[model samples]
Target: MKQWPFYCEQECEQYNVSSIYAPYLFDTSLLFFKAVSTALDLYGGNMSFYDIVTNGTLIAQCSVGELTGATDIKCCRHQMFVYNKTPVMGRTHDCYYNIGKKEMAYIRQLRMIDHENVNKLVGFCMDGPVLLSLWRYCSRGCLIEILTNDNLNINIDGFFIYSLIKDTVEGLYAIHRSPIEIHGNLSSKNCLVDERWQVKLSDYGFPFLKAYEQPKSSSEQLWTAPELLREPEAHPTKASDIYSLSIVMADLVNKNLSFENSDYNGGADEIIYLLKSKTSRLIRPVLEPVIEDFNIGFTHLIKDMWAEEPEQRPKIDVVRKIVKEMNVGKSKNLMDHMYSLLEDYAASLEQDIQGRTKELVEEKKKADILLSRLLPKAIAEKLKSGQQIQPEHFDLVTIFFSDVVSFTVLASKCSALQVINLMNGLYTIFDSVIDEHDVYKVETIGDAYLCVSGLPERNGNMHVKEIALMSLELLKKIPDFRIDHLPNEKIRIRIGMHTGSCVAGVVGLTMPRYCLFGDTVNTASRMESNGKPSHIHMSADANKLLTEKVGGFVTKSRGEVIIKGKGVMETYWLLGKQGEALLNVDE
Candidate 1:
């Protein structure tokens, strides 16, 4: 491998600057050698040294390495400058070379003018590649970003706007009193905001270094005074800084970028050209909409600060006085105002929580009502409490089975929706009658409804009487129950009841049912199929409970009807209550 040396121009006469960079240069040569070895091995060691040197593609492809020795690449300065996503530390990398009395005085002046609103210049960097001025970084970004950010949900009322304006004025006031005597570039972009919403004016007081910098763009010149625009190289004056301050004030007032809503929609370059013209058009940002909320004199004061003649503009102290007057009755500081905002939020906190809790209670009540309809109230409570329900036995309870007569023929002639409407209309009348008695509704099949008067909550032998009275009322309502699809034709249902021992329990996990399992259920269903339409049929056990035990019910003998499941059963036709007239029931 060939040896190479590196040096900078300044130290060329003393030594090949390579002596200072010898360690790093040696590592570079070793890396090149490693790459050649990799390339030669890749090609089976068939290439000559001339062939290896000439193969640029092979060397480029073999640049990968896992070297152990490493050193940080940095400027020769002793202090390490750390970089972060939102760096609290930064470097300028352009401190002027001369560093004479004027430069020293200017830096000293900047260091002394460190007010809360003005950025603090920490120190200088001279030993690095370029000179640097270290400044305390403002992490909350600048006024330009704050005003232009649409996603930011800050409660920016008039009080917040006044605090920012007050801070900017105070920073400029501090600079005007210092030896530098002017903030050469005062744009919203340079006015940074801190985490606490305090504005700190940056990039101020570096006139000597600024002379060598690039020329300002037309967009940047939007805030420049007319006099400064005419004499481009003339040093920035206190009056020009005031003019720039007004442009920033316009941005805060309108909550936009500088001159973003200009009347001359021709953009920043066009606005600069129009202002530079000799015509008497006093070009300034429109300050109407936001200013109306403040004192009328506030608008006049800002216009005076940016007057055409430098002599007519108010000094920093005079501008500060008017700002104080405009904010006389307001909060003394932003912190106090923020505390007041928190107090207001806390005041309404209890009421908001109470209202939400009341709505939650109402919604829970509605859900419970719906759940009770799906299952018996006692069973629903047991299920909600995670109780295991075993099959329960009832000695004597009346089971009522009901279904529409000729329902298949009626539904076949109507549409599906119409059949649903017909079922709903007839069941609604049955449900209202059932509500008058003490009974629990079981599951409803296609045209069949199952009900019981004693198991979930038993009511002694009164279950037979309750079921008997409910069935009579249900048959009475069928006369007025008209089908919407078949208007002229009347609807009818056959109801049957039996009283005997049965087992009942909740059945499944998904759509669990309060199901009954016994021969009593089968006998009641058989009684319905054997009975005539518009009539209530009862088995021997139910009739004995109603007439002998409960009394007041009138029943006629059904007489050894051929029940499908039970061979032959003597059922009875329940006519009406003893004191009431007999129902016009079909035989």
Candidate 2:
């Protein structure tokens, strides 16, 4: 073999031990002497010093040491994961290097090490069927998985790019500062991402033991420094790690696989071959089409990072400083950036909700106004809330009934549309007059309108006064009211009211009517039917309530005429007011 080939190469090296033989990590340790003696005994012949080291795996097994007492791994079918309370992830690798004191101490040191950007090594299973190294599980996968997943749904802008690249750089920076000194394995795949997009570096250093554990795949070799590929026995230096970081940066910047748009068309193997073979034109990932839009400083810095010569690349500290400068006024944490985005979204959503709420309120007001016409407001509210409204009895409420006099004769002279227009016009005036007093307009049947007070919402003794005023005002509006179709004819209404105890309720499911029941409503209708045109007729009870209980009105006696239902009931004429002359309905 021309060069000593190892999977991870001399990634973990002690600089002071270079003066000693370069073939093994621990030449001074007792395990190294024992291994050498064992190797010499097995060979049983004279061999050159160069020949032993040049044999690659032979010298490696003879030179490196191993820690003893590796217990067997057990598996119970029923209680397999009963003691696995701590969160951990296990991985297997090729059995090549043994665990010496140095490798054992390396594992302990890694277990002790804790950093935000580093994944902690928990323990390992060496004596098991396979070499299993456990680590804390990262929920979100590596960088490539995040970038390639079509359903991630995250909008990758400059800030997103900044956050990911920033995290990777920070992880590399931490490793460089750690006791391990250099991250031997620095690839996008080795960089595990979390839910918040934090990047943590895993599987680094301890090159001797790791040499045969993880053999390099062609894709994994894409991030390797060209010089490391050229020299088979070379160690992965800080500069080489920086080279790996540059490849990852390119992956983030371009938002694709490493060297995805490179000139090598023959796939990963061809690209690795090209990377080793130096040509006039350098073989590196191009910044490409979006390079102009990137920060000028970042673009130049990135190019410097991937320079062909190892010494030409900037230090990790310098790279960190420049990256920090690029993010001067920006958020350091991705979670903070996402929170800012959420706040902005919430503000806009709140405005939209407020607009919808305003429109709902306006529409509800319109519906309530229309509903008040159909039933009393209290009753309508009860029905709206799915509450059944029981029939309510008012001890003393005034009921008013009115009709357009000779309505049949008038309607017979006109078409249906004209009759409707006439009634609408007449009621429009009466409705306007009724609004001034406290009364609920119940229902209108043809030309007859029934209005009442002190039932759904009661008022003390003022119902008779309200009814009396409303009746007079309605009759007063009759002379001025004109029919649109018959302009010359004046509209007259015969009004009758009775004050007595009666029951009021919503009577039906479809097109509900707020109807009044008992003799008071009937007597009031009879009074209106028996009334003269252009006057308000009142029952004895209503006249008594108006004149005595609530004295505010003027009335005229329509002497003892036998009522149809009740015999010999004396009624009265509701004239204008106490101050005005009585309205002459006798004409």
Candidate 3:
């Protein structure tokens, strides 16, 4: 036997255990254990060793560990541990190594046993006296843990339970049909649950290894066939496996350990004695009352599986067919059931999300309307879309300024409430007229109203036309706006407009205002202050724009008047449309 340098006596002395032996590495060509990198003391004083080895044709590494722990899963003499290996790039075939003449025979046979309900054997480690077999890791642990756990809270229906039985039967059938021929040791503890909740059979075809393990107790021999119990040296046959499956099925249906509900007064020792003596009647787990409510045919089938005569037991293939028949109209497969549950949950979540989305849209609509009232529609839309409203420069725009002719005199004639009522009525009329044009109302200070056109959206020279038409309409409507307290007293307003470049943008955070900046706004205000009652005053620029660009309006020059800002500036009095009079009195 050839040994690797990793097993040198000097390095092996580091662990303080016995030096590496010679026969442990016999058959140099069949050697699987290369080197031990780390060791873990698993439950029950079992040792788990890790090593890196070549996988397939690639340069990748694999983890090989021994199964040692009290809680570790056991199937006969073979203890199982997790075997994870990363495939090397460009590798076509899987990597493998021989353990020994006896173990390699079982390994070769196990390699041919490929089924969804069977755990795959990746590799094995036989370094020194340690014998470790590597199998795929089942994340959900063993079926014994699931059946015994009280806090797991697994919600299983009758059909779902039957599905598990059917999977077990199928797994057994695969083993029986393979070269392995029969599972010498079949029990609930050997059944593992994968991440998909599918049951897989583990720990089979290793009788040589089982010889080194501890002998099974009478309690653990509950699944052993009557003939096997009588002859302790006899190997498990197909009939004994069938009898064992019946006990496992009973555990599934009863949700308890095998023979837990037996009527025998004595313990498992007494029960084993009776079965072996052949003097007492054959004893099995008593079927619970709930089993009667389940398929009566299923209960009868279980009885046939554990029949006193080994020849009377059904074959693995027949058991699978019977279980399939029992699942005709039962629940779907485990994966399908899980997907159905998730789909239903997702549908309910989608409905809740849609309801919340509808409420959000309605609230957003209300907020949009409120914002539009404070700022221009375009600017409000930009703000809602998370865009910064940069101040815009308009080369040509029309600004309109208006106020009551004598708001103080009108207020002095009425009480404060009457004055408020009058102002509300008057502005309401003007606001309606303002809406008839494209001009946006900028602000309202007491009796003064400010508006602008050609921004935040531009309409070129059309701003002059829009503002001029709106001013004429306002002048035409003011006489009809009588105070509620003094109905007989007619009201009049002074209106002014100017056309020039100005900067407009939203200002402030609390209550933002769409403010207009530049001398054009001030000149427009001056025109409104220096105007006559029931008249529309216009700056020279506005008058020129109204005459040349928008010709439908009638305007007469007010001549050069001494303005506060300028020495003498020419202005105009805006009349009305082409043929209409400036004052349209409602008699």
Candidate 4:
């Protein structure tokens, strides 16, 4: 490697400059190297060096093993100068002295030009074998990494992809328009994505540095223009940069390496060989059929950019114009485009949540219907609200029990389905009558039906009136109900009523039942069992309450009937209500 001489001719004339300048320069270099080495050694290879002159600093000395993505590139932090203000990232490489000089020469030329999509050159450090070139740091990393990373949650829609292409074209056009008329080497790997996902062009205008760099693999050669690949001595021109741009655009769209879907299956080496061959057919990256959805204009633009002949390719400014037209009425920039997309996504998410909520409400309604049929509305509501239920006592209540006459005989005469139909039809009529009164149907066990009023929700003396009217209505409906299976057979129900205090509560957990307890319920059951079919039998308490308290019903006494398990008790046969019939009674 060549080193610049520290002493001039006039300084040599005035003093023993060789001895003084040589040792001083050599010692200064050695001392600087020793300081960096000590920092690295003390920290176990984690160290940073600050350049006092420019206020540029390297945060930590990155090792070859720590390098990600690329082998030759070491990403480090740097600042241009104290006056330059903002810090930036630097890509460092150990290159031959001649290559470093060549790159520095080109960089000096680029310092005057500026563009938004171009990575701004901060400064450079030529320390020993290390040649570091500083450029603005793009936190989001390179285009290739963004394209290939599966973990990155990027929305790569048409607008987003086109925005990147437009930015890339703008950068290229700026370079073409400047003194640095060409980016000899342009590729997806050289294009970077900033924090805002804006694509900025890098690794340009340093042909000498690129010359001594390791030969790219055949895969990487996919971005090289065919003319350059064919003619090794040809330098990269504006036309060649456009070709590379097309390859990068293809990678962005496909999210794959360039020419990944080419029909040529023999790998990158074979494709390169074919591309360089004079007689071989031209091969290009396969643009997916889906690309047509972006617009045919974009498709045609790419085709023209990478035309086989260098002269046939479009100019960077022409490409920029077309991209601008493509984006004219659209979002002004990438951030604006992303904001619009996010808003659309939020709207879609809200719609999905609303639809799901509506479905949930409908399912809850179905569950409520099933629960209401199992228990009273108040008890069901309490259970739904996660309230604990305890046994409740009613001071006075009317319990009613009823059963079909000769139900067992009728069931034996009919098929299982016919028996179900018979019961359903009979109960349908009874249910209609039950709905008219303020009573809760407790349960029905086979042929027996049980109901009560003023327990779960109290109605004072109205229980007697509600139960009397309910039982009378049930008896009236039963006489009119005919069994569907036995059309000629008349249906009859014997109903019994009792008025007394009782305890009611919900029981069990799996399939709960609201049950009434105490002698009142038993007495009511016995009254129905001991009475004749089609008759409304009432205990003395219920008869007294109905006649004296309610005063709407007429009754005849059935005195001193021996009740099961309760010795003899006075009972009465409820004949009929006021202005109603008392027909076919055994008086």
What tens-digit string does per-residue lDDT give for candidate 1 at 1-587?
A: 23222333443232111232344555676777788788878874677876876687888788686653322223321122434433333445333467788778778888887689998877765666666766666655678887767666455667778788889999999889887899998999789887677899887877787676556789878878888888768589999999889888878887787767767778888888877884687888887645345455656878898899989999889988889888876646987876676677666777888998999999989978988998889888888889988889998889999988888888899998888888887788878888889988887999999999987888899999989999998887788877766788888888899999899999999888889999999988887888888889999999988999999989998688888857888889999999898866554
TM-score of each: 0.65, 0.51, 0.45, 0.60
The digit string of per-residue lDDT tens for model 4 on 1-587 reads 03322333443332111222343355455544554554555554443434322221422332212322222244322212222665465665545655456556677888767888988877666764567677776656677777667765445677777887888888888889888899887898778777677888886776666666556679878899888887756578888898999988787677688888777768999989888885555588877734434755776788888888889998887888888887666646789878878788778879999999999999999999999988999999999999998999999999999988888887889998998888888778777887888989898889889999987888889998998888777776677776665888888888899999999999999989999999999999999998888888999999988899889688999889998898999999988788887635684
Give the higher-TM-score candidate: 1 or 2: 1
Tens digit per residue, CA lDDT, model 2, 1-587: 12333333453242111211222233233444465566777773877655654565775687655533111132211011111675355555555567788888877877777888888776766886666677765557678887777766455667777778888888889888887888887898888875556888877766765566445778879999999889866589999999999999888887789889877778899988888888777888877534334555666777899999999999999999999899887645788776776687678879989999999999999999889777777888998899998988889888888888778888988998888788787778778877898988887899999888887788999998998888776666677776776777767778888888998877879788888899888888888887888878888888898899888688889898777877788989888678776677573
Best candidate, lDDT: 1
TM-score of 1: 0.65
lDDT of candidates 1 onward, in order:
0.79, 0.76, 0.74, 0.77
> After superposing candidate 4, which stretches have Cα over 4 Å from the reference?
1-161, 171-244, 251-295, 308-318, 328-331, 337-374, 383-386, 406-409, 412-421, 445-447, 483-485, 507-519, 557-570, 583-587
Instruction: Estimate, for each residue in 1-587, the C-alpha lDDT of model 3 and write its tens digit.
Output: 22443454444432222222322333222234322222121211453232223222211122243543322233223332322443111101122334578767777888778999987766655652445556665656667776777765344556556767888888888888888788887899878777687998876666665544566788878788889888857688899999989988888888788878887778898888887887756688887734333665777889999998999999988888888887677556888876776687678879999999999999999998898888888888887788987888899999999988777887889887887887788888878988888989898999999999898888879999999899877776777766656767887788888999999888887787889999999999999988888888899999898898779888888888888886689998877788775643221
**Backbone clash tally for model 4?**
0
Instruction: Give candidate 2's total backbone clashes.
Output: 1
Candidate 3 TM-score to native: 0.45
For model 2, the superposed segments whose C-alpha errors exceed 4 Å read: 1-113, 121-164, 175-296, 299-318, 325-392, 403-432, 441-449, 456-460, 481-494, 504-519, 522-533, 548-573
Measured by C-alpha RMSD in angstroms, how accurate is candidate 4?
Answer: 16.9
Q: After TM-score superposition, what is the CA distance of residue 257 in candidate 3 from its true location, in Å?
A: 16
What clash count does candidate 3 reach? 4
In candidate 4, which residue pairs clash?
Answer: none
Candidate 3's C-alpha runs over 4 A off are 1-108, 126-168, 176-318, 326-392, 401-436, 440-450, 456-460, 474-496, 504-516, 525-537, 547-575, 584-587
